[model samples]
Target chain A: MKLPEPIIIDPQSVPSLRWGIIGPGRIAETFVAATQKHTSQRFIAVASRTTGRAQEFASKFNIPKTFANYQDLVADEEIDAVYISSHMSDHFEHAMLAINAGKSILVEKPITYLPEEAEQIFAAARQAKVLAMEAMWTRYLPQSTILRQLLESGDLGKPELLTASFCADNRAVERLWKPGGGGIVFDMGIYPIAIAQEILGEPSSIAATGKVRPDGMDEESYSLLNYESGARASLTISGIATLPMLASCSFENAVISLGEPFFVPSSISLKTKDFYPEQTTWVDESGIAGHEGLSYQATWFAKYLSEGKLESEVHTHAQTVANIRTAFEITKQIGAKPF
Target chain B: MKLPEPIIIDPQSVPSLRWGIIGPGRIAETFVAATQKHTSQRFIAVASRTTGRAQEFASKFNIPKTFANYQDLVADEEIDAVYISSHMSDHFEHAMLAINAGKSILVEKPITYLPEEAEQIFAAARQAKVLAMEAMWTRYLPQSTILRQLLESGDLGKPELLTASFCADNRAVERLWKPGGGGIVFDMGIYPIAIAQEILGEPSSIAATGKVRPDGMDEESYSLLNYESGARASLTISGIATLPMLASCSFENAVISLGEPFFVPSSISLKTKDFYPEQTTWVDESGIAGHEGLSYQATWFAKYLSEGKLESEVHTHAQTVANIRTAFEITKQIGAKPF
Candidate 1:
């Protein structure tokens, strides 16, 4: 039994988009650097609220334009699209600003804090006839495409259970404990929840428990999603410890394990449940190690824009809404203050 | 840093007891076979509710006597101890009968269906001046001893999180779906719950969700346990699918993983979280494979009986009750019918 090769659109083959980046933080840096290095995407302008952070980011990336505020960046006619990489709390505002300006947008994971906000952003984007997509880069990775092919091939049969966790020690991040700041749920929990949504669709119900800091930020959480087909996904996220970030699904015929750091470029192993079971492992040889894989989403976004699509078919507007809705239910059940 | 060696008492050094078995089931065969082969423990009699079953088991194990009724087996003056491997629903009745007859007893895991029943069984044993221990054989494994020592030595530091799962495709086991059959909670769930109790102590609160069979038995479940010290354990159990049966604990200084099939003789890996992390893996070299490891608990029971202990210190009576109580809560929260 062989795993199928990923059908990837070469980055250079896709139309390049002149992009403006909002919120020049660490993730934004990775997005800009990786996209420029690996894809034909271009960064025309950079924006940051802080006085010179925009220029500093622009200088490092050799971008020609810089804006002190996001408004000017979105209004720039030279920018074809905007990548919103601000704090999760500001994703809705910046995404709305980009959508209203008729600029195609690629927002980071958790397009907005609330599902309703995501709906509003997509609604405005639809009205403006501009493409909008959540930069759920994991979906665009070559390994993920291979996984999708395997799932669609029906070799594994029906999925019965899924277990995934995203945990790390991030106690030093002060914003994580603040009111508008995305707590563990939005910041880290979205990965497992998004992947679960991608695999299981929308869950019928969610049961969750979590530990919250005195300041109302959740430090850790566990959410159990029950699907209509009786498939369950047990997900765990923590900001208090470093755990094995592994994800696996138990199907009727085999178990598929997405190797450690499952959200990144990793290996996939399929072990059949036959009497004489055969195990096959496929490792991502894309050579786009770590966050460099972020370039996949950038290139895909450019291709979607060139195709004149209103939303990404890979990580759709509906999926972004559903993922955040699941996260919302988890936050509500855990009794944490919502972002 | 070296892992601690297990301080195991030689089974031959402990005073051997003339044993009478209640419930001549598959597990009982394993218990009798492993104990007789590995330890000085001797089985004098066997009993089953079915007339020929006792005689069959007795003939197979080379026991001297057989009884169709448990009363006669417990009343046998030569029998010093009774090994109750009855169905979980009958554990309380069998254990109480053995305890009331002034016979030491080693009941199977999940000593009883409910915490109250376990309490009654332990109370009867206390009044009868006899030893009573839950056959939570995992605690007696050599790797478990090393895990305990690592936690006690302040090398792993304070445990912050635990994740464990005991899942398999047990749909063919008709008894698992029947009322009073113990379901998934009392059956496979006890393993992870018992280990969690050993490591994290009693949880202050539990949140759980599950899928129940049409017959009202739980087929799968997920539980989140919160401790007063802010530590947490996430546990999952299933009767519908075969899953990765891995257990791990995240501590302040290191993360320890009990390799697959963790409830039996397996490997232990300790990876420290220092600037330069060190990983050490230890495999059990005792050569006691699988069900054969059941003998360790029997031999330990013999030693505890010789020491005149009313309950095992390794898996205390209170610990058994607490573990059952946690399972009870899970069943209740998941809306499964109680056994």
Candidate 2:
């Protein structure tokens, strides 16, 4: 299984993974930084819809090469992997371009604006025998791994319920209110849905409700998911508000809750009946958020490419496909457009 | 308008409200301790369904009156109010007795376990001109009041979403699993649902899913509610297991989360989107569990009674009825028995 943990590479002795950015937007800039500091991942080049922006970002980031178009980045001979931080509506095209070019790809969240687009990307990856993963960053974070472990260990008791919300204060952000790739659930909800499935297993039934934007997208959505094991989850994500953005699991003997900065929290709690209710928090002792170790995801891609691995264990191709479909179902229930 | 703050009062300092208790359980003990330490309220009598238990509890707690039959306590002219903490199934009958006896009443959670009973009790309160309320402790907690203030004042921004769960480590508590009120939503889920309505206003529509026990009650429930303001909420509660029993609100700029012991939390967080993601935590300086001026609620009731106010603002006649009905609706959505 592909774990999202950062690889221990000696910066002075070991070579770094060569990753190229295929979109020079703000998220792309953050991707470059993550690839640079989160792991021993090197930024080889950058591509932008606009040549000027790509060249400027390349120069600012001190990358070795720049591409005027996404196709150029995918075909770059020196790039081992491509990070697709394109518009939500463009994920399918860019990811397919990079996969067919024989490079491992990391597509930004929502994977694609629609589930069919995600299916195409996955199918292409399977045909090309290249590594592909939907970048649900929270899945790769340390807090998430700890939560999964706690749930499996019976530390909190039998997992019975979970409630999560991944909303951002996106009301002031124009894209959230617009029809194309806008709305809180599409932008922020994907995380909670995916995480809920990862921890609680596939839901057997779904009940959802939400507030739709004037443009027909779900600006905010809430969903109740029921699993075959009788476990249930309540998940909400919105583009117009701020939520703890963390997942919580309840058990028969104890409770495990995530501590915040919501989306990027570093600590989680494990309390038991023996302790009655002891407050425990795990802070990031590594302080690696802005360091090369943060791009551990890029490093994982480099390994998969070199080792010829078909999929990542941390985020399997099957999981990504399922999650994207879940997002669509939730939206559909809330009276929003599927894309 | 009344604020929900615990008031510290000693019985000797002022006139005490004479009260009678009809149960001998942990929650009953809490009522006793809260009245003794937190409010200027006196336990004048106790009824335990039998002379042995009634005499034992009264002797243990130093009560001045003891009744083998619960009806005797209600008929006592000296008692001003009756606190009914008996089985949820008995609430309607017992409350009717107290109302006929002309005593004000405060009953345990589930508020009779039936919407019909809630309506019955509410109508009776109006007819008798007596103060009657459900002892939803969280509604009277400082955390809830503070949460309301934050929402009304737009501190974190408009409510984007709400996610709350209540699950107990019900390893040995079988009564909680009985037919009438033995599931998570009826037990723990109502806290968050009520809080959501109090803060975000009533939801226009709601969808729910859950695991139903053999006895016709849902053991666990997950519900999604959409408000007219374009806001949504996800709520869950269960007796099957422990997931982080938390109550969290996501707003436009920040989030506020709460959990056990929820009535008196150890800490709370307010996160805003500044450069550093401005996060602040408010931890209680006091180191007591559910002992944070809990007696104040009883005192507030006593004060209201003295002031000739039939309904205290802290626990209004209408809000308690609405909260219980909301719980009933959630269960109704899941195809479970409401009572």
Candidate 3:
């Protein structure tokens, strides 16, 4: 069986937007670096709670403006959109701040701590006629496009089972243990959960079990999502150990697997169920590696904005809300503190 | 860190028993072939429901006697022990018959569909002063011994997580879909569930969800087993797709993984969590491949019997019952037809 190819969009072909950064952190640094290096999108301003940090980040990223407060950044008329890289707990406030100012916004994932928060943010953005998208960068990668095409093609048959896990030794990360810090569910689990929702849609039911830290944060978890069509997904996430980050879907006629670090640019293989089975593998040839692929989301966001869209067509608002809802249900079932 | 080595026992060092076969089926053929080629254990009698089938199996294995009934085989004066490879639904009855006849028996996994049945079989064997062992087979592999030692050594720290999956396309097998045929839970899920129980012991609770076919057999399933020590296990089993049959444990200090086809003779790898992670892989060097490793369990059974043991020390009766109990709970949670 011939595997489908990804429909690659050149970053230069999209209309560039003057972007502002909120709560410039480590991930924000990667996002700015990747977008600046690979896409035509430009970062014009940055903001932090303190002016000193904002100035430092602005100087590092070669931005023209810096803000002592996120409000100032969102109010800046020179900025067309804001990348909300604030702490997960602040995503709702930051995103709404940008949307109220009529600036299109791309918020870091989990998008918000709860599904209700995300729904409110998107609803506000929709009413304001400003675009809002969750920065689920994996959804914009070329491999993800191929995966979507594969599922749509129906050549692999109906997907029966999906398995994905994200685990790493992040036990020393202090933020994860704090109340409202969102823990591993938001930090790592969202990747697999988002992808599962992307492929299998909303599950009919979910069963979850896990370990919780003394601080009331979930340390590790396993969730089994059952769909109405008899499709199932098994998701595992942890902050205490390093596990193979693999995502795979088992279909009636074939099995498609995304290699380790599945949420990033990686290899995808398809093995057909035949008397003499045939296997084919496709690897990323985009010349972009690791988190550098984050640029794809930026360019796509720009294209969506130019198209007069108020939400990402790839990672839609409904999908983001559904993913967070699944995570919320898992957190509740595990007896962990709600985010 | 240097990995520990498995302590292998030479089959010639043990006193062999005269074995009698009940329900000579496909698996029984593999057992006889592997044992005759790799161990000193001898098969003296063969039995099936019909005289013609018994004669055919007996002649193929060059056995001296054939019995058309399980009772006749178990009562044979020269037969020291019986290997029960009967239909899963018949395990309880066949095992009780052998124990009543004062015959040692190695029953195929699962030993019985329910924990209560297994308890009765072991209880009867104890009263009769005869050996009764569940032919888990995987527990006797050299790699399994090494895995046990690695866990006991504490080099991997307290095990925090375990993931194991067993999936294959067995939809074509008619028996699996039939009522009382034991479905995928008994046929395939037992391997991963037994190994999980072997490594983690009894879990505090289990949560399971799956797809049940129209005929009431479980088509696929996922389970989360939570332990009191904050350890969690995620298990996936299916009959609708072929999954990478790998088992792995993530520990505080390191991760140990059994390569694909983990329930059989395979490679083991240990990766330490260090600034510069160290990885070491050990492959099977005993020249035993695939089902050929079935001979290991037969040899171990002989050794245990010669030592005057009424149960396998490696996979104790308590452990076997615990594994079935886990499976039973999973089956119930998935709402599949009980065997």
Question: Which lDDT tens digits does candidate 2 get at residues B1-339?
Answer: 112233333334545879999776667886787667655678989998755987877787789899888888899989999988887778888888898888888887767666677888878876898888777766655555555566556545566677776666564677766665445577667677777767677778777777676656677777777788766777766666665556667666566766454555445566664324566665555443555435546766676667766675755767767667678788887787735
Question: DockQ (Cα-based) per candidate?
Answer: 0.37, 0.53, 0.39
Error of 3 at A88 (Å): 1.8
lDDT of 2 by residue, A1-339 (tens): 111232243333334667788877877777677656556678888888774998899888888888888887889889887888777777888898899899888888878767778888888888998888877766656666766666556545455777777766666676556665545677778768777878777788887777786667776766878788766777876765665556776665555666554346356666654324665666555666522233655655666666777677767877887787788788888888735
Top candidate when judged by DockQ against the true structure: 2
**Quick one: best TM-score, which candidate?**
3
CAPRI-style quality class for the chain A–B interface of candidate 2: medium
lDDT (Cα atoms) of all candidates against the true structure: 0.86, 0.70, 0.87
Candidate 3 CAPRI level: acceptable
Least lDDT summed over 10 consecutive residues: which range in candidate 2 chain B?
A: B1-10
Model 3 scores a TM of 0.90
Candidate with better lDDT, 2 vs 3: 3
Docking class of 1: acceptable
Per-prediction fnat values? Answer: 0.48, 0.80, 0.52
Against the native chain B, each candidate's TM-score is: 0.97, 0.88, 0.97
**Predicted candidate 3 versus true structure: per-residue lDDT over B1-339, tens digit per residue:** 567888788999998889999989888999999999999999999989965998999889999999878878888989889999988889999999999999999998888888999999999998998889999999899888888888778777777888899888888988778866668887789988987887778899998887787657898888888888777888899888776777888888888888668888988889875423478988997888888989999999999888889999879999999988888888888888846
Q: Could you tell me which residue pairs clash in candidate 3?
A: none
lDDT tens readout by residue for model 3, A1-339: 667898788888998899999989988999999999999999999999964998999899899998888888899988999999888898899999999999999998879878899999999999999999999999999999888898888787777888999887787877778876668887789999988888889999998888887657998888888898778888999888777777888888898889668998887888865423468989997789888989899999999999999999889999999998998899889888835
Candidate 1 chain B, run of 10 with poorest lDDT: B270-279
